[model samples]
Structures are given as C-alpha cells and as structure tokens.
Target: MSLVLDNVSYRYPGSTHGLHEVSLDVRAGELVAVIGPSGSGKSTLLKLVSGLTTGHTGRIVFGGQDMSAMPVHQRRMGMVFQNYALFPHLSVLDNVAYGLKLRKVPVAERHRRAQELLGIVGLSGYAQRGIGQLSGGQQQRVALARALAIDPQALLLDEPLSALDASVRGHLRDEIRAIQQRFGATTLLVTHDQEEALVMADRVAMLKDGRLLQIATPRELYEQPASRAVAEFVGLSTILPCTVCAPGRVDLGFAELHAHTGSRPVGTVLHAMVRPEHVRADPAPGSVNRLQGRTGAQRYLGALTRYDFEVPGAGKPFLAESARPAAEAIAIAPEHIRLLDL
Candidate 1:
C-alpha cells in the first residue's frame, strides 16, 4: 500500500514545536528516507503516519484512506524502533510471535508465521535463544522480524540500526533493504545519518527546523542542491566567492572559470560550489584553466588521498582528492572548474 502526507502540519502547545506543512508521498515497494538533524521533525512525521500524535491540519493518507482518523493499530503500519524494544524475558520465537498471538491467530499458525519472519531476517536458528543472548545486530533483526510478522502494509523504521556497531549497521542496512524489496512493502526510514539516506533510499526528504527543504533522489540532492544550505548539507563542496567577468565566465582569485550561470551583476559576490573530486592537482602544460598553488596539507586516506591547497588570495582554501596512490603534484586548471550560485 502507498503512504502519503498531504500538507501535514503538527504543532506543540507552546507554539515552538512540530512539523510545518510537510508534504510527501511513498509508493508501494519504494524506500524513502526522511533525513535531517535532530529536532527537524523526522520523528514527528513518523508519529503522524502511525497515528501516535494527532490534532493537526492536513491529512495522512494510506491505501487511499484518510489515516488521521484511524486507530494506531488499525493503520496496519508496522514500526521498527532504534532500541529494538523486544521483550527481554521472551525467547526470540515468542518475541516475533507476540503480535500474531495478540491478534488471536491460532497458536500453531502464529509460531509458523513467526518462524517464517525470523528466517527472512536470517535468524532461523535463533528462535530458541533468549533475547538477552543476542548481539545488538541480532536483536535489531528480531525487531525487524517482529514488525514484519504482522504482514503490515507499510514499514516505518526509526533509526533502526543506530544502536549497532558500524560493521553491523552496514550489514543490517542491506538486510533491511533486501527484506523490504522481497516483501514489496512501502517503507519510510527516519535517520540523521547522511550516508544511510544516500545509500539506502530511493529518494530523500531533507528537513530543517521542522520544514521540508527538498525531496529528491540521492543524486539530485547531492549534485543539484536547490539552496546554499541544501548544497552544504548534502555533500562535500568548496564554496568560493566569485564575480561575473562575463556570460559563461567567472573570475576566481586563481583562475577564470567557464560555466552555466544566471544573470548577476558583474560586481555581485556569488558563491560557487565545486566538488573535491572535480578538482585536479597542478595541470598539464596545455590546460586552459591551469593554476599553481602550494600544497598546504596532504593526507593518505586508504582509497583516496586528499590535498589542501592555499589559493593565493581566496579567503577559503581549495581541496582536491585523487584515487589510489594520490598524485604527488596538483593539476587544477580553469576549464575543470564550475560556478555554482545560491
């Protein structure tokens, strides 16, 4: 089933809290990650969908029905939390089966369905183990299994892997995606981790101060950010001050760049963003944009070596990166530069 928020807004009693006119849609079988810093309304958005909080304007729609009026349990949306929230006293099997039992499914049928879910989460033999015996990752898998056992129309995950170690987090992220894909469940992931949003979601909604900044695919958000804040938040960038020399050309302290840009007065101070990878070390002899500068600090970072260079008069330094064995020399030139305006 599809899930959608149509111009949804929530407010706290004091007037200084909640989501503001946020609108988004989640299609069946698609994974959409709501990403932002803390207090940006990610959790509030989830509560609205699950009917945990109410008394706001706009509608929460699910499967073509208005969900705002539906009881939380009637929404048929399963939720997985950051802390696992499993019953420590229950065996893994029972923890996964608890929901089915509560719904009054036959005892045999509940156990059968719960075991199936455990298998989907790669916890086949773990059914008999006590919850306390499981590792953080295993515990999260159990939580996922429990959520899935209900055969929910949609899955809402709140920082689902935050409690696990880095390695476990990576593994579980893939696992969650796989399970969701297999079941074709409409899924919404709430997280503050940029990497998690970039790698896991079909699309992302970036929020700030309880407002939706932008919603787009990971590529769109990272490469064509709509604002200075969006660009700075989505990826690594070097925003340098530049003045328009003419159409398609702008002058930086070190080089003249040719790029697509809008009409700005010649003396206007505009910010230009360039990705580190787009930058090269000292250029080849015939490069049009070649600029020379002293390398300030260079460090080897396994897959890539990063260099910090001091541009003669630019207030901020330039950063460039090279793959594998980093270039001993810098090769930046004017032609490789792009002028980004915000």
Candidate 2:
C-alpha cells in the first residue's frame, strides 16, 4: 500500500522542544530510503507511521484510507528492526511462523508458509537451526523472512544491515532489495548510510534537525541539491566560502572559479562546493582552470584513489579523487564546481 504523511509534527512532552514537521509520500510498490544524521528524526518518523508513538499532529493516509486512528497491529505493515528482534530460544521455523500463529493461521498452513519463506530467503534447509546458531547475516535473513511471511501491505526496515560485517552487509542488502521487488512490497528503509540509500532506494528523503531537507532520486540529491546542508549531507564535498564574481563565476581567495549552481546577486557570499570526483588532478599544460598545488595525503581505496590537493592561499586542501592518481597540477572543469545558496 502507498503511504502519505502531511505536515506531521511530533515532539516529546513537558518542555518546548525543537519539533519536527514532516511530509512525504511513498507510492505503492516503491522503495524509499530515509537518511539523516543521529537524532535527526529518522526513527521518530518510522515510529509515528508504525503506531509506536502517539499524539502526532498531522494526517497519515495509507492506500487512500485514513489511517490516523489505526492501531499498530491493524496497520498490517511488516517491520524488520536493526537488532534482529528474534526469539533466540526459538528455532528459525518457529520465529518465521510466529506472526502467522498470532493471526491463528492453521498450524499446518503457517508452517508450510514459513518453510516457503525460508526458501525464498535462501535458508530452506536451515529452518530447524536456533537463532543463536546462525551468523549475524543469517539472523537478519530470518528477520526478513518473518516480515515477508505476513504478506504485509507495506514493509518498514530500520537499519536492518547495521549489525553485519561489511561484505555480508553488502550482499544482504541486495538480497533484501530483490525480495522486496519479487513480492512487490512498498518499502521504507531508514538508514544513516548514504551509499546504501543511493544504491538501494528509488528515491531518498534527507532530514536534518527535525526538518525535511529534500526528497529526490539519488542523482538529483547529489548533483542538484536544494540547499548547502543537502549537498553536505548527501555526499563528500569541499565546501569553501566564496563570493559571486559574475553569472558563471565565483572568487575564492586564490583564484576565480567557473561554476553552475544557484542564482544570486553579484558580491553575495555563498558556498562553492566541489565533489571529490570533480577535483581533477594532473591538468594538461596551460589548461584553462589549471592551478598548481602540493599534495598532502593520498590513499589507494580499492577501485578508487583520493588525494588532498592544497591550493596556495586557499587555506585547507580540496579533496581530489579519481580512478587512478594524477600528476601534481590540478584543474577543475568550470561545470564541475557548484555554488550553493546557503
């Protein structure tokens, strides 16, 4: 089912706290990732939708029905938690079938369904194993199986892969996305990992300090952010202070830069942001934007490389990265730089 929240506001009682005013729409069968820093109301948004919290000040509509008063159990939304909230004492089979048991699906039918779900999650033969016997990734699969066995209208996941090791986490996230697609479940994944959102979600909603920053496809959020905060949050960027010199240029302390982003009056102070990938190293002789700088720190990170290129009089270095390391002189394409309206 699709989900919608309009002007939803929530706050803890007693003192006047900095409240959150949230609004977004999740289409049926679409996967959306909610990302933010710690305490930016990501979990609170999920809690309000799942009926774990009360006294919300706005409307929640699900599948075109007013779900403002619906109770948690009645919502029929499947939730997979970060900690794999499974019964350690119970066998995998029982845990997967427990939700069905609560709904009083006949014993034989529920077990049959649970077994099917286990197979769907690639754990067919491990049904009899206890939760403690499985690895973190295996336990997470079991949690997913349980959530799926319900055949829920919508699925909610709260950092489901946070506990797993790096390689396993990467593999399992793909598995979860595949399963969600196969079942056509409308999913909401809450995560602090930006790459996870970019790789897995069809659209991402960015939040900060109890406010919604922007909601867009991963590319839009990265390439055309609405505010300086959005650019800083969505990816790695070198945000430097600059003044607009003309329609397509901004002046840093050391040199004038050409860019495309934001429309503000001349002489207005703004932030000039350049992504690590846009910071080009080893320019051709006499390149238009060529600037000489000393290299500070460089690292070979598997498929990619990163270097700190320190421009004279620009204070700190701008982060430069590429598939392979380049020569000392760096050049930035005019279109690669972005002026952010703060």
lDDT at position 283, candidate 1: 62
lDDT of 2: 0.88
- What is the per-residue lDDT of model 1 for residues 41-153, given as tens digits with 9 covering 90 to 100? 99999888988888879998988999888888898888999888899999999999988888999999999999998888889999999999999999999999999998899
**TM, every model:** 0.92, 0.96
Q: State the C-alpha lDDT per candidate.
A: 0.83, 0.88
Model 1 global lDDT (CA atoms, 0 to 1): 0.83
Clashing residue pairs in candidate 2, if any?
Answer: none
Model 2 lDDT tens row, 107-149: 9999999999999999999989999899999999999999988
Output the worst ten-in-a-row residue range by lDDT, candidate 2: 12-21
Candidate 2 runs further than 4 Å off: 15-19, 261-263, 323-326
Please give the RMSD to the true structure for each candidate, in Å.
2.3, 1.5
- On TM-score, the candidate that comes out on top is 2
